[model samples]
Target: MKPENAIEVRDLKKSFKVYFDKGNSLKEKAIHKKRNRYEIREVLKGISFEVKKGEAIGLIGHNGCGKSTTLKLLTKIIYPDSGSIDMCGRVSSLIELGAGFHPDMSGRENIYTNAAIFGLSKKEIDERLDDIIRFSELEEYIDNPVRTYSSGMYMRLAFSVAINVNAEILLIDEILAVGDVNFQEKCFDKLKDIKRAGTTIVIVSHSLDQVERICDRSYWIDEGEIRAEGDPISVHEAYLTAMNQSMQERLEKEDAEVMEQHKKLGQARLMPVFCSDIAERKGTFDVEFSDIKALNSIGEKKRTFHSGEAVRLRFAYKNPNHVPQANIKFSLYRDDGILVYENNYEFATGKVLDLKDEGEVNVEFPTFGYAKGTYLLNAVMYPPGGGEVFDEINNVFKITVFSEERAMGVYLLENHWEEA
Candidate 1:
């Protein structure tokens, strides 16, 4: 029988002392007379949450964000520095799949060994051994040494043994990502069955889609703290928004630093120019695209084009000083930010041009090999090595392409199909 509250964690805090070794041998250590220094790395800060019987919870975050550490703490693999964890009923953990199995032992022997570690008696193991091996689909290789098993095979056997354990609380740490798609679906179906049978589960995974599908709720952990706790989909959305914002800020800062270095080198002047057209302008101080216009096949200033039509992209630049070594990189992106193609002017031609005043640059795409959809054009100016970008206009222009044939994806590959 499952308890009402399967697990309750209160102000959980854990840290480890990371060591820096000076010498490996005792003689060397004595000669150096230096002690190894250590730094305290806090893996889990004060965090609190609860899991009810039959509830499936998810822990999501970037790598080293304490998701795995929390699972380890729950399994008592490591003791917490402070705080309390109230766990009820028998617990079985698959922290690292096949972690405790003997490499030289046969898969059948390893199953008995692992199950015994999970608190199964010899008679209990005997009763479930056939079912476990059948579930893993490894009956032929059950007597083979585990060292010869492939990763997917190992995972199948490990998960099979784990699910067979009579555990009220299951701790899974991204083990489901292993194996083929068919086996993955089988694992999901099995999980659903177990969940319906009142088995509590805690899964730590990077796959937000799987998390949202399997977990009743999710907690986004960041910097060893609970950033958000709510519905799985909403929590994942919040996490993604925060991650994108942080990435954008870091990129902007890097761009600013690059421009500042260029200013110090006397390459260009730093001036924050204001854009008169808010809808089409995007850039920093070093360079700016004041006006951009797209021309169709008939030389008309339009933002839409037909398949295989000639499209010309024209843009005028504004700069404070001469950039003799600068080049322009033009790229096409889908509405969802997938880059389709990119081309550079000076880099392709092996020529450098000076831009001291308002200059015009244009590029023509003779064959617009894209399916019917809306797209964005991104223009960026950079130096020879592209170590730093002078200025970039993301989504400089939004254009739509028309096609007669309904394609599945964005690209249009030239292919002729005939049935044999």
Candidate 2:
């Protein structure tokens, strides 16, 4: 059988040459050649992978681990030191906040410029302009320079133009992290529609649930290499297990070192007492455990949910400092890190959370709007009168979406359908 692929890569390598001074002349170039050589920042490390047509794949790894570097090479934003990105069909990328736009231009003008760069004709941009503006929900601000727009607004317009390009293959990074709830939902619905049109997608996200939900498969990258690929669940599980193990190992080593230092110094850094217990979803089950580390709580909470079910989460914890009026938020992701839902509990309007008490606060949201498959839930706690977020909870839970007997519309509709 011939090698199967939609995107082909072999022995990919990329490096950046760091120049200390920009004004160096030819004489300096010669002198540097004879004396000090330019420093190299090796980004991609001889990695390789292939993506089949109509397949959705997720890429995940630590920060600065060449995930974005590979995307840049694929999109031709930067040339690789070695290797090739062999792609067939019309391709488009929503990499790095979705679009390249000038801040001084109006939304309309920037859309025109960006669309043309994506290989669309002026007439094509004109045809899509209305659709773009409507989707971005920036009709009033369309005439304003993008420099005046908020980060969320800027991202909205950029994404609006990106999805309308009608490319055969689309590349997306983590742009959904900034938009509000309503806009994010709209964009996600559009993504589902785009996938149905047979456009291949490659998403690089920290949202494991989004990857597991939409991706036909996934690619796990580690240390600039493809560590795992195939089914999203299997690959995701493997990665999580590995990460947990690594965290455990590090904690153990640190504990031993700290104890040894304390013996010699008479007293050492005071290790914070851990609540220790945490909730985590193991494949399909919800897990709770305590006292594994004796110090800081060392695990995450995870669960799976189906559609139309009452999605309820109770957060329980202990913090010494009293939080007077904190801005607490919950974020949902369809794994691979595409942010699905996010909201903060500010003491504004009708928001209230008595985190000072020992009782758990149960957060309930109807889940009928979500499609079938597993989803991830993230919870964040901020101190009262927040200047900076002190702590974070990562991938706390997983929720599954069901749509068999429960199926009605694309997602479960809250309204009752009466026969006409």
Candidate 3:
């Protein structure tokens, strides 16, 4: 290990044996040996990284991406198949809280038992016992049997004991959701204090915002390897972009399958091409929306966009009756039910659509001036003068806007500041 580094990992590799259906009893195992067949699943593929002393880093990836496995190796809870991990100081982990607790033991007794697992001496645990109990806010029930405590209480006690250990290195998994929101905030503040005290911290979490607030650096792990590592915001932006692309591909494939199924069934009307399974629909069947998608400047489908980026809504409709004239309206509403933008084609251009057998329309926005938040989309087609509602799809789609700037309100306006 480098002298300046608190943790050094070299070409780490690990795998596990995933077994097929196998018998539990000895007699059944002997009779059906073939049922024990298994396959080797490689979780970490020669990944390497180092953490400087007193620096906090986060491991982020989708589930089953070997991030948790890497943390387990760091804690020595699991052995790596091929690689070396070096640590410069004593380690403590919040991976499995209450691992050494006995259900019948009192909360106070379990605190000592859990602290002992971190190699604390009897005198050392005695000194921290009061602090731990106080931090857990369980003084009233400290002497009660842990089995009688609620799930939140139990977790609070475990977390208090672990955090008070004051180890030189702390490895935390996704245990921040242990208690209520208030307690969770308290834990976050404690972590910040620990960082200021120069303790080396490594976290594995799916909450990107948490990582951004706490970690000095972030490593993006994917498919058993390190895909990117650097500043939290940049790395997370790349990770989210890749994830969005993957989702787009999946949606396209599923849409194609749905179209094929409709053709096979000879359905009179095809289902909405891009509407989510839970999307609500209401229409008179005289004119029905067959497809609706939110796209970017280059005509690529996307549900997420940066605030001020160009956005366009592309929709296709079928008019079996060939209605002479119709009006189209699209509205955007924030998740809290506040309307952001709503406009009709007739009002904007003094023209209404001359309906035909089938057609597609593109509504373009050069700059989507929405703040950073999710907005619900609604599409409506009705008579030119607004009589009977021909069709209306509530929540036809959800558009998410992201912004790097720090500001408030519903609109992302263009402005500049200068000294007078």
In terms of TM-score, the best-performing candidate is 3
Q: Which portions of model 2 show Cα errors greater than 4 Å?
A: 1-5, 15-43, 98-100, 258-420
Better of 1 and 2 by lDDT: 1
What would the per-residue lDDT of candidate 2 be over residues 318-349, giving only the tens digit for each residue? 54444444445667777556676676766333
Task: Give me the runs in candidate 1 sitting further than 4 Å from their true place.
Answer: 1-3, 22-35, 257-339, 342-358, 362-420
lDDT of 1: 0.80
Give candidate 2's error at residue 153 in angstroms.
1.6
lDDT tens digits, residue span 185-238, model 3: 999999999999999999999988889999999999998999999999999888
**Candidate 1, TM-score vs. the true structure?**
0.65
Candidate 3 CA-lDDT value: 0.88
Per-candidate TM-score against the hidden true structure:
0.65, 0.59, 0.80
Winner by lDDT: 3
Model 2 root-mean-square deviation: 13.6
- TM-score, ranked from best to worst: 3, 1, 2
lDDT for 286 in candidate 2 is: 17
Better of 1 and 2 by TM-score: 1
Error of 2 at 342 (Å): 29
Q: Tell me the TM-score of model 2.
A: 0.59
